[model samples]
Target: MAKGKLVGKKLILLGERDGIPGPVMEACLKDSGADIVFSVTECFV
Candidate 1:
């Protein structure tokens, strides 16, 4: 298996999911070894 370069990287995640929050995506990023320093999401209803 290959390792990722994000093993100790800082990230700022500003993501949206079809105008909604993407918790799953956020989790995936975190799982990839990124430390979320800031995050923001938007939702439309």
Candidate 2:
């Protein structure tokens, strides 16, 4: 992965069930050098 803009930043990822999921986003950012405070996937009707 290329250098991430989130390097050394803290984040909270909120994902949607119909969209990108939280865990998936986390995986993408795992190597971004950011501290993920939390990740959640919310479902909507």
Candidate 3:
């Protein structure tokens, strides 16, 4: 069996490098019931 970090834990997304600039990805995650503990508009990666 494999234990996951996000299992039953509050989610915290630092950055979502969508290969573009915008809050599209962030919004999508929020709609999907994500906690979104932390986030950034632009990611370094």
Candidate 4:
């Protein structure tokens, strides 16, 4: 398995209810070994 390059890096994801990166972001998280920490989303108002 390829070791994560961001093992100690911090990651944050901010998305809208209809964001464009939902799937891609998920894939990144799955492949990441970094401390995948927090996520926040807000509805378009």
Best candidate per lDDT, number? 2
Which candidate, 1 or 3, would have the higher TM-score against the true structure?
Answer: 1
Cα misplacement distance, residue 11 of candidate 3 (Å): 2.9
Candidate 3's residue-wise lDDT over 1-45, tens digit each?
A: 324453345555454466643355557655454455665556574
**CA RMSD per model (angstroms):** 3.4, 2.2, 6.1, 2.9
**Residue 20, model 2: Cα distance from true site in angstroms:** 0.5
| lDDT for predicted candidate 3 compared with the true structure | 0.52
- Per-residue error for 43 in candidate 4, Å, reads 2.6
**Decoy 1 TM-score against native:** 0.58
What is the lDDT for 1 in model 3?
34
User: lDDT tens digits, residues 1-45, model 4?
Assistant: 437677677777766777744445656676666655666666777
Candidate 1 clashing pairs, residues 3+ apart or interchain: none
* Model 2 TM: 0.82
Q: Which candidate is the best by TM-score?
A: 2
Write the residue-wise lDDT of candidate 1 on 1-45 in tens digits: 325998788887666757535465577787777777887776544
Go through the candidates in order and give each one's C-alpha lDDT: 0.69, 0.92, 0.52, 0.65
Span of ten consecutive residues with least summed lDDT in model 3: 1-10
